[model samples]
Target: MNCRKVQYYLSTFSEGSFSSDKLSEVEVHIRNCKSCEREKFILEEILVAVRSLPTKTTPDDFNLKLFNRIYAEQNNPSESYLPTPESSWIRRPIGWVSALATVAVAALITMVFLQRPVGSPDLPLNSPAYSQVESTSPVSTPSGKHVGNRIPVSAYENIIGVSGSASNYRATNVSQVRTLRLADARVESLYVEMMRRLGAEPYPNMLRADTRYYEMRSPFARTGSNGSPLLRNAASTISY
Candidate 1:
C-alpha cells in the first residue's frame, strides 16, 4: 500500500479494529514505510499528551444544543456544521482541528486501551457444556493415539461410588445416562437426580431433561477410543 492509503486507514488500524484480514497487510506496510511509521509514532505521542491533560466539564446545555443542531440539520439536509472546504482542513491544521484531534485522541485511548476483549464461551462447572466434555473417554490425537485427558472431570464434583470396571465400561455420556432411564425405576430416579444436579429442568422434560439432542446424535457419543461401551447395554424395555 502507498503512503496516502496507509495514512488514510492508519486511524482505524491504530484503534486496533479493522477487517480481520487487513492486519498483516497493514503491519507490513507500516513497518516498511518510514513516513507512515513516523506518523504512527507521532499519533501515539499525541495520545499520551491527551491522556495527561485534565478533563473539562461539559457545558450545562451541551446536550440541548447538540439535539437542536441535529434537528435543524435533519430538517434542512443542505445545512451542515462540518466545514465545506475539507481539503484545507486536511492540508492545514487549525485551532478547531487541534481541539477535535485532542478529543479524538482521548476517545481513541479509552476505546482502544481501556476497552476489554470479550470473554470466550465458557463451559462452567455443572453446566451441560461441562458434562459434554466430562464423563467421557480421552480425546484422540492426530496420530489416532490417545493421551489421557489432562482436564478430566473433578473427582469432587460427583463423589459417586464407582465399581472397579465402571470406568472401562458403563454410561460414558449423557445418552448413556439417558439410556439408563427406565432401565429400572431406581436407576431412573437416580438419573433424574443426576440430570437435575447437572442443571437440567425436571418434570415433562425428564426423559431427556439435561441432554441436548445434538449431543445424543454426535459421533463422539457412539463409542470410546478403547472398545468401551458408549451407550451400549441398551435396555430392551425403553418406556419412553
Candidate 2:
C-alpha cells in the first residue's frame, strides 16, 4: 500500500472501522512511510484538541439584539446605511460635471440651428430680388457715394423712394409706393431681427450711442415712415 492509501484509511483506523486485510495493508504502509506516520500523529492531535475545547453557549439576549438591529435597519434604512461625507463629496462633483456637459451640448445645438442658412427655392440665387439684395453690399450706395456701414440707398429707395419724389408723387402712385415701402420695411426688419437673434450686429452704426439713424431709418423704425403700427408689428414678428 502507498502513503495515499495509508492517509485515506487513517480516520477509519482510529475508529476501528476497517477490515483486518485493509488494516494490515495500511499498517504496512505507515510503518515504512515516515510522512504517513507524521500525518496520522497530527490528525490524532487535532481530534484530541477538538474534544478538549469548552462548549460556548449563546447569550440569553443574543437573538433579541439581532432582531432589534434588523428592525431598526428596516425602519430607518438611510440612517443605518448612509454613506460617509467623503464618499458623497466624490459623487457630487460627477453629477455637476454631467449637468454642465448637458448644458454645453444644448447650447452648441442651439447655436448650430440658429446659424443654419434660411435660404429656400423661393429665394433662389438667380432671382432678381435675391441678386439685388446681395449686390447692395456695404461698399457703395446707388448714388455712387461711399458710405461706410450705412444702410444701402437701394434699400432706402425700395422702402421710401428716391430723394425729391415724396412731395411730387400722385395719390394713386403714393398708395402703391406705400404698399411697396411696407413690404421692404418688413424684409429689412426680419433681416435685422434674424441677425440679432443669432447674436450678431447687422449694422455697427445702429449700436453707436450718438447714432439716431436707426430710429430715423424707414426700415428700422417701428413704422415704414407711413405710421403703420400693424405693419410694424407684423414685421417684428416675422420668423426664419
* Candidate with maximal TM-score: 2
**lDDT (Cα, tens digit) per residue for candidate 1, span 107-142:** 653454234332112223454434443445544434
Q: Kindly list the per-residue Cα lDDT of model 2 for residues 79-101, writing each as its tens digit.
A: 77755443454368776775576
Determine which window of 10 residues in candidate 2 has minimal summed lDDT: 160-169
TM-score of 2: 0.25
The residue pairs found clashing in candidate 1 are none
lDDT of each: 0.44, 0.47
Total residue pair clashes for candidate 2: 0
**Candidate 2: segments with Cα more than 4 A from true spot:** 60-240
- The TM-score values for the models, in the order shown, are 0.24, 0.25
Cα deviation in Å at residue 89, candidate 2? 56
How does residue 166 of candidate 2 score in lDDT? 21
